[model samples]
Target: MGAVLGLLVVAAGCARQVPPDLVAGAPATTQAGTPAGDIAVQVLRRYLGTPSENSFPERAFPTVYVMDHTFGDAADPSGKQAGGAPIPAATQQRIAEALAPATKVVFVADRETVLEHKESCARVKDDAILITLGPPVGDARRVTVGVNGFVACLGATWLTYVVQYQSGDGWQVTGTTGSMSIA
Candidate 1:
């Protein structure tokens, strides 16, 4: 009987070990000093999806988009200026306010990326936004999130986002806007 009890204890200890698959598949968590891009991508993935029928029956879009921008040039790095309507000043101001009380800020922008792997959606020039926030002082216990996007079936969409970390509370969405045309 004692031998059997010892064996059971050993088996339980082994079972407590984390599985290799779970460790590999686990999503990265936000830390106090996580990079801006990492935080942005994490936030974006969390909210990427079509809205429910009751929310917006006329417009439903995909969750992921084709990322074609070069590294480090996410926010109009060319300096020549691309052809598309810029994000409105009022909207931009709101985004800025959402990311208040931060030590640093990063900006990213891209154009001509396809949305939801759909060829027709690609032509629409959909713009997506993602924001990530960190704690005020010590390591962040959680992340604050704010995302917005506009998908125009007939026209172009503009995307922009900001990341900030200072020290505060759990993650929350401050603002968001999205639309897509079916016809």
Candidate 2:
């Protein structure tokens, strides 16, 4: 038994352990510090490493648009995203306010303006990340919300996600409906 234990120790010492895949520099999250804001941050965290044009960067933040709502809102001028549940007004305000400090969370209200502003996206260093939040419905301990992270630049890219979060705990990405890029 002693010899076997000694052999196990030797083998363990010979094995090499790999370090966790840490972000090279500061971790970049969309966290705005509010309950919903933090939830959005978690959503962004989940999307960061996925296959996308602007994959996760070695940074602490990314500028994203904070729209009026998701699923069904005037944010999309085409009206295809209409007839969906709207995010509560108070909740939207809270998220926008919380996110303002870390990034420029704009509410352009229409797709035309979004496109218009796209011209200066590179100049201003904006990633064109539009975060349209859905109605955050939940009880005291848990909540679920819809979020769309759309990029108007690079021929456009988008991901519509539903996130469920436990109050005072971690986040859960409930859904990733679809993604598309024009070019």
Candidate 3:
């Protein structure tokens, strides 16, 4: 009987304890998959040249921007916008082709549509032209890429992008949005 009691005590101690805030039927918390910010930066770098190079061309209009989206404030482009550079036409094409395999890109022409979608969609929003990327079915992840023209200073714009995946009950931002600025 002593041995049985000892075993029972050990088993009881080993049992998992739920935190006070967690309800009995609550779904188990899950960590996100691979970070989307790192992937986005890597992809951009693969297409565009390194920082040392004169990546932003002087005459490129509506320049291309890529940011980490995990650091700075999405509202103020100047605050969090980190790397701003222009992407050459060829490089832009390459980026599209490369990202085509995993992401479905949607381009929003005007600011109103972008704002509308950002407001309506069950996701966070920033002040930028929205580019929504839908993952293939069963992926359970979505990426929103945005570019705000003339955000920080004259002739400057910023890119704010976010990666989110479904959590236990709802979707959550995996990491903060990454941003880039170009002038």
Candidate 4:
């Protein structure tokens, strides 16, 4: 476990991105077994370095990290909706499998189960990470997902990244479309 800090759940933009130099190694190259799984792992890795994934990068979260399987009440980054819906069981399994290599202790379960567990943790408001994945569209070379690091009722952020295949580059995060944060 690490220190508990503020929350930051990000809702990303369409495709506007930061320079490649800033994001460095954002390529989807992992043993997650599938493209979506690979992308999810990579995106989570970006946040795991922090306590609430964005705001508390310096604080250490002092327990096993819990991820809600379904998007639950998380806002949709697609702009076509508000909260996200449940992901297929297969998709959940794939992403969960890929999460094993993330180093930090983590587990994926239903919202109810995760919420129940969260209630029993030392820090209730600043733990759980809710996740949502946008399926592969077009040529299946591009994918996006949302990560919500809940640190408190108000402290949080939402940032969405645009990941695309660059022919010889494989699946890489070309840019971030948008981001919102609160502390």
Candidate 5:
């Protein structure tokens, strides 16, 4: 198992960086089949690379799992409200339901979708997830989930993660502080 995991990591390293110029005219998109957990890390790296920027690069598909930022509590805080009113607790809770350890994380297993190199890689272009944890603004929270061969990150850090196509919003489940493993 260790050898296999190591090999997967080594193989991932082979993916090679996509130069800015090539990112647009590249012959292919990032192939799927990568563990959801691995894709989760890429999401983090994306957020870390550029803070306060919202993007939904479809090419980053199969990577449906997202880790972005918002402003709200476990259940509708001031940040996640309408007309300045906090969002309903039930709605907020429902959104965070994925935080449970028992929650199942889904992935896009469609080989065709995964391999389609010419697919339109558009941004999320919506305000779907609009909540995070703790005080508004600088007060960030770190939400994580681990289950069903997947993991995620959530918090003031601007990350909203969810298993691809699976119902229910992303969760804020807890796991090792910095421990990691590959599927």
Candidate 6:
């Protein structure tokens, strides 16, 4: 048990932290000192790294609402992800069994924003998104991509993912999702 705990600590320590750009009083600014675009990419990458083949829903769900900036809104007040029933232990074990080859994927930030759009749904006042991290990403990029999922970066983990995109404009993210943990 002590060995396992030590390993977990060492693995968690591997997380990378990159200083984020801050512009206070600016709604477009990154939150908690982390860039939204970077966060999106990091989450996407971690998900891909995991064994399970949880895929992102087809972009078929068109979201017409776009704002000039992006932000993170706690979907769960305590920041716990809800709605999806608890994953079964057996299923998790199966996922761990079918691990995919580790590969690096890159995403660039083309445009990101947060907006409330009422044109799409009426049940709520408007559609709300915590953040929108987009990169003008496509097939031409050097890094490879596969089915997406989430990775658990437990306690105090910080991630810095940089993607080299066109026009020499690179992208970066510097934090971990608080809820991304298997324990």
Per-residue lDDT over 1-183 for candidate 3, one digit per residue giving the tens place of the 0 to 100 score? 000011011133442211111112222222333322233334233323322111233322222322211212222444433322222233334434545544322222232433323333422133222321111111224433333333222334344334345455233334324435555
Residues 1-183, model 5: lDDT tens digits: 000011111133432221111112222212332222222333333332332333333322223232121122212112222111222233223323433333222222121332222245312222122222211110012222221111112212222332231223321222222222221
Candidate 2, 31-119: lDDT as tens digits = 32334445544554555435452333443335655554344321222335543333344444544565556555565444455544544
Query: Which segments of model 2 are wrong by more than 4 Å?
Result: 1-41, 44-62, 72-79, 117-127, 134-147, 153-155, 160-162, 167-170, 174-183
What is the lDDT for 141 in model 1?
35
lDDT of each: 0.27, 0.40, 0.29, 0.41, 0.23, 0.23
Clash number by candidate, in order = 8, 0, 8, 25, 17, 5
Top TM-score prediction, candidate number:
4
Q: What is the lDDT of residue 22 in candidate 3?
A: 15
The 10-residue segment of model 4 with minimum total lDDT is 1-10
For model 6 the TM-score comes to: 0.22
Candidate 5's displacement at residue 85, Å, is 30
TM-score of 2: 0.46
- The digit string of per-residue lDDT tens for model 1 on 1-183 reads 000011011233432211111112322233443332333333343334324311233543432232211111122112223231232233223333444333111233453333343555433323332221111111243222222233444332222222234355333333333221122
Off-target runs (Cα >4 Å) in candidate 1 are 1-32, 42-60, 68-155, 166-183
- Sum up the clashes in candidate 1: 8
Answer with 1 or 5, whichever has the higher TM-score.
1
Instruction: Enumerate residue pairs that collide in model 2.
Output: none
For residues 1-183, could you state the per-residue lDDT of candidate 4 as single tens digits? 001111222344343221111121333322222344445556555655544436765654443344423232232333332332333344445545655543444444433343434434422323544333333222255544444555444445555555665666556666555454544
**What's each prediction's TM-score?**
0.28, 0.46, 0.23, 0.52, 0.18, 0.22
Candidate 3 Cα deviation (angstroms), residue 98: 0.8
True-structure lDDT of candidate 5: 0.23
